[model samples]
Each structure stands twice: as structure tokens, then as C-alpha cells.
Target: MSTAGPDCPQKWCTGGACDGARLDSLLTEEARWLWEQLAARADRSGEPSMTGGTAVITAPAASTQRAAVLGLLGSRPLAPGERRRIRLEELTLRLRQHGERLTPGAVAAHAAGRALGSTAAERARQIARTTGLRKLRARLAGALPKNARLRPSEEAWQELHRTGRVARVLQHPQPEQLLKTAAEVLRLLPPQGRVDRRLLAFKAAGDPHGLDAGTDLAGLVLAEAAAAGLTTSGMPPRTAWGALGVDLDRLGGGLLSLGVHPDGWLVPARFPLPLPPATLADVSWPAPPHEAPGCS
Candidate 1:
């Protein structure tokens, strides 16, 4: 009955699964057509990043989202000394920013133990005290010290996993690459009229292998909805958040501006854009003419 996902917990959930699964089913059908579009494009320009590379990642159930991502892509491990040096940088930052001087051994020993010490303590406190980007900066400052070591502190490791994943993300989409890719996806939009989530995929003329039709459609929806100032109060049945909350969280907010809704709808936030279309093509069923008049 819980509409909230494993990633977001129960924030917007109205205490039921609500429209999540239905939205997923609808999106899958659109993905079939999307793949065909990509194939045509691929036959021309060698298939850009949208449909290249494997977005499908496998990781243990216990792994955090970032860990699963890193585990799949693999990360360059840092030596303990290197980790310690990074920890010192974090301490230096704390001193500079907060005038809080935590000792090295205390931080290092706390590294392998429960994060009840000054660094995490300060972070938790700072996170609580601040708001918006200030809080984010505090959290980042708090996170740096944990990157000092390689092993899991749960708290420390989770933070580092995010930072590490971000570094990996930076390696791609270079500067404007992601924004451009998003633009390509957005260009599919009519620039004014609302495109049904289902029709947009087939007509969008993009089927990048890695980019699933569902997410692509969802991104456009967010862009339109943002411009329209559409809120959950006016949302139609079966929102995107229910179905793809966890997946979106892994992608984070900055790179993908999905709003609170899942990858189901709304429009534009920030850069970049995943799934193989063929895998779902077999069972896909599209509406015939007169049934869904908008799809061409």
C-alpha cells in the first residue's frame, strides 16, 4: 500500500501504491517505439550517448545506490595513507569554515568505528542547523573527512560513495554535453502543447539504447509541467514517482531535475539523460488508430 519508494521512503506517499505500476506499464509500451526511433538515428550518426553504453547495473541488495553504481563502473581505490590525507583536508576545511578543530587521531580512529565523533557529529549538527545550499555545503564538508579511508563506516562510506559517484559522473557529459543531450530530448517537445506521456516516446524520434522511453518521456513532462507550474494537486492519475523513485534518486536531482514526482512526468531541471527498448518490445501493445489519436 506504500506509495513511497525504498529511496524516498514515505514522503509524498498517500499510504498506498497508488498509480505507480500502471504508469510503468504505460511507459514500457512507449519504450518499444522509442527504440525503433533510435535504431533509425543510430543507422545515421553512429548512435550518441543517449542510446550507447549499458545503464543496467547489478549490485547487492544491501548496497547503497552510489555503491551499486560504483560497484558496476568500478572505482579507483585510494591507499589508507591517501585516504588519511583526504581526511586531513576535511579537517582543515572544518577549521577554516567552522573554527572547529578536531584532532587527527580522533578522526582517524573514528573513521573505522561508529561515526559518533566530531566530524559526523558536526555534520549532523550543521545539516540540522542550516538550510538549502548552506546545509549542502556543510554536508559536503562533513563528507570529505570520511573519504579519507576506504572501508565502510556506513555513515562515512555512504557519503564518500556519493562523492565518488559524482566524480565518476563528472567524467562524462563534459561541461555542456549533458545539457545538450537534454536539449535533444527536449527538442522532441512541441515547445507549447502537452504531449501525452505515451505518444511522446514513439514520436520523439529518439530511442537511444541506454535511455529508456519512460524516463525520456518523464523528463519532457517535467519540463512542460515546470513551465506550466503543474503541482501534485493537479496531477493526473498514476504519477511517475511511485514507479521510478529509487532509480531517479540514484541519478540525483542536479543532473536530472525530476521534481518530487518520479520519472513519469513534469519537465526539465538540469542536464543529461536509459534502458534497452528491445527488451520490452516483445510484450508492448500500442493503441490503434482512433484509440489514441495523438500518437503518429
Candidate 2:
């Protein structure tokens, strides 16, 4: 991969950095496929479909700058067959090999030295800078559900098969509806709560980046349930197993629970024996924390 120089395509790139570009490309295809899978899974469960489109990546020094760009991403939702977002990074991490003016860690240290009011805010800045908007856009695009309903007229699919960048499939409108609803529900929660729930739900659905692409609509359902006061203490771990009619303790130890409240709060508990490394085989809570699809 060529470092950022005259040939690099990125706009914000400085000092001819190029290492992240290859990493960016390598991950793009897989990420796009994963988004489709997640969207499809959400659709099957009657949840919202993750939308795909171009993303704009940027990192600004102030929240106002970040907000301005985010507003743009919100406005210009990327449509299918479009490039991912424009990424922006605020950190000074060098991308390409430099003679030796600054070390990669040095930039990080410089950002760290500029102290901020809150650690969370600072951390958020760091994350945004490192991944930028491009990465997030790609992840969202890649993780969206594969729409089978939107398949081009047989002729269209054939015509574009060679030129199209994304897999052409028609998805039901229902998934999109569910995702919209979920996004609404997410807004009801505090930032922390929303973040934790999204992260957890993505994990529950087995997302690698811990970003929800609608793979586990259970999180959506759970968020709604919490908002409605259905599960105040956060959905119990057993709810997952109970749906399958399996006992936690009967399964044994290896799983734990991270419960999120509607207020953006989390309550973590060591499962089976309050210990780490607990699995389904080891869990056997008497009452079964929650209900599942087949708990009769």
C-alpha cells in the first residue's frame, strides 16, 4: 500500500500517512457484508433495518465542530451503492513512516496533555479521531441487513452486477421501520445507557465491533421494554436462555450479566457463581431471570 503522498485519495491525510488506508480497505468488504447480515437478522425479528450509505469522517477540537459534521452525516444519509462517509481525525498520529520528527505515541501524549473537563469527553474525542467518521460509516454500511426485497428487476441486477459495488438485494420495509423505532427508543435513554445497551446488544448478537447493526433486535425490544417499565433491572440473562427453555445453573458457569437501566446505567453481575468464565452449562438460577420464546 502506498503511503499518503501525491497518490493518496484521503483529503484530511497529512504527512503522507497511508498505513490506515490498507487496513481501511481490507476491512471494508467484510464490514459491508456483516452489516447486511445484521440488518437481515433484525428484519427477521421485526426490528429496524440498519441503513447503508456514504459517511463523512472528521475530528475537530471542539464538540461544536464534531456536532456540525455529525449533523451533516444525519442529513446526507448514505444510500446503497454509495461510498462510505468522509472521515476526520483530530489526533496527530502519523499515518506513514516518518523520518523521526514525532513518534505515534507522542501525538497521543500531546492530546492527553491538553486536559479536559471530563475524561469521558476526552476519551470520546480520542476514539472519534482514531476511527474517524469513515470507519464508522463503513461499519454501519457493512453491518446493515441484506435486503432481499429490493433486488433489482432481474435485468437490473444483471446490468449492475458488474458495476455495482454492493450486493443488490431487496429488503422489507419493516426492518427499516423497526430500526427507526429503535433509534427513537435509543434517544429516550441517557447517552451512557444508550451506549452500553447498544454495545451489549451488539455483543449479544455477536457483532465484532460491539456496534449494533440490528443483529440482536432483542436489545431494541429490551430498550423499549425498559422505557415501558417492562424490565426495570435490565433484561435478565436468563431471559435469553429461558426463551430457549434452558436453565442457567444447569448449563454451568461461564456467563455473566450486564444489566442496563433506562437511565443509562449498568449493573453487572457475575453469573452462576458470581464469577468470571461462567457459561450457559453452569447457570441454573432457580426462577430463570426472564422469559424466552419457548419457556413453557
TM-score (C-alpha) between model 2 and the true structure: 0.16
| lDDT digits (tens) for residues 82-149 of candidate 1 | 21112233322332221122222222212222211334444555445333322343343344333221
Q: After TM-score superposition, what is the CA distance of residue 200 in candidate 1 from its true location, in Å?
A: 4.1
Candidate 1 matches the true fold with a TM-score of 0.20
lDDT of each: 0.30, 0.32
Q: For residues 214-273, what per-residue lDDT tens digits would candidate 2 score against the true structure?
A: 333444344323333334434475453233222234323443445421233244443222
Off by over 4 Å in 1: 1-107, 110-179, 191-205, 208-220, 227-234, 237-296
Q: Mark the 10 consecutive residues where model 1 has the least summed lDDT.
A: 107-116
Candidate 1 lDDT at 205 equals 37
